[model samples]
Target: MALKETRRPSIFWLMAWVCFGLLGGSVKFRVAHPERIPERGAFVIAPNHYSEIDPVIVGMMLYRLGRIPRFLTKASLFKIPVVGWFLRRSGQVPVERAGSAAAKGPSPLAAAREIARAERIVVVYPEGTLTRDPDMWPMRGKNGAARIALEQGIPVIPVAHWGTQALMGRYAKKINLLRRHPIDFAIGKPVDLSEFEGKPIDQHLLADATEKIMGAITAELEKLRGDKAPAHRWDPSLHGQSETGRIEP
Candidate 1:
């Protein structure tokens, strides 16, 4: 099933599709269980983030599935001139630091409310940034995706993709697109949060929900890559690595 388009594609999205379409020609997108995405309405997509190019791949994959894609973009990007104009016009949500309530940007719930105002897919990286895993496994999830879902009463769909690291390493400054890349996206069903339906939003509850969301995505990634993930998800705090910036593992 494909997501139902509720509105016409804006000029930015139209151009974005054409641009990403050309980029996709050089990279093969092998999608599995795309039917997991709902045919209508706004829903959160929780995907593992390992490479800087991951967002492009996810956006391309969603558009291929008949859905217009949006993202929780960094607030700094919105401060730029031309790129910011495109991002705002394209309807991407802006956040200071995703999933952080104390951060000095727009509220996370406000981002969710904005997402609910439309019918597009919002791709959220629960890890908040590139994974610090030495092997690029999914790391500990932030509460942004879960907090958004719970605040706005939307589904959190767990998705995972592999092979982008081969296109470009985690902290590498260069991206090699000379060779055709085969990237696989495994879209899992919406994570069930029935247990937390009426509970007051709290740090404990958000952490648990984030765990389930990340677990579902990790499971999907394991299936796509056919490799077992680490027994414990990587935590930057434990490894003395900065949480929001590049850290070689």
Candidate 2:
């Protein structure tokens, strides 16, 4: 696919520097196969979510690649002061959670489709939120990315990252910068959803495609960590967790 031509607002660079300053000193970051990221086209950049810092790390990676990282953020975040201003000004899309009366607006997925159609990169956490897996491996993903890929006919690039958890544990209120952690990112080739492209977008189809996306991410994570993933992916529901990606105490 040819790269699309688009203009990134100044806020994108502003956020880039902010993220860099925040993370640069604390961790050694490396990205593999960054070339796999399409230089000029609309594609889904799906990465496993394990920490609050994942976006900052991944955003830096994409920014360095000359792609403006547009995220599908939670709508509530857009209500914050400085953070919200940055998210909206930088072209990030806001998504409302299910059954929230405050979610009065266009669907976030729809906004994502618009961004992709413009030939821009859209970063999506297929896991939806941070991984609930105690081992930090990616859990079963939602169908949002899969549906977008199939419905929009855009590519879905699976990226696996490790070490962010060490920098900041999941949902922990404080960050540990006691030691410099190495944040490793492995970018896989675009998932082959060609077979499902023309098929009807259904629950079964979305589930199947989402599995492939998460599977690719897991495979790369295994390479980065040199560790084996669980025999079966974890489902938060079965583990007494909520769909919000939180592990219940």
Candidate 2 per-residue lDDT over residues 22-134, each given as its tens digit: 77788887889878988777899999998887897888777777778898888888899998998998889887777754368668689889998988889888988888888
For each candidate, give its TM-score against the true structure: 0.90, 0.92
* Candidate 2 Cα misplacement greater than 4 A, ranges: 1-9
For candidate 1, give the lDDT. 0.82
lDDT per residue for candidate 1 within 33-130, as digits (tens), equals 88887878889989899889888778877777777778878787888998888888887878776455437677656776687767556777889889
lDDT of each: 0.82, 0.85
In candidate 2, where is summed lDDT lowest over 10 consecutive residues? 1-10
Candidate whose TM-score is highest: 2
Q: Give the TM-score of candidate 1.
A: 0.90
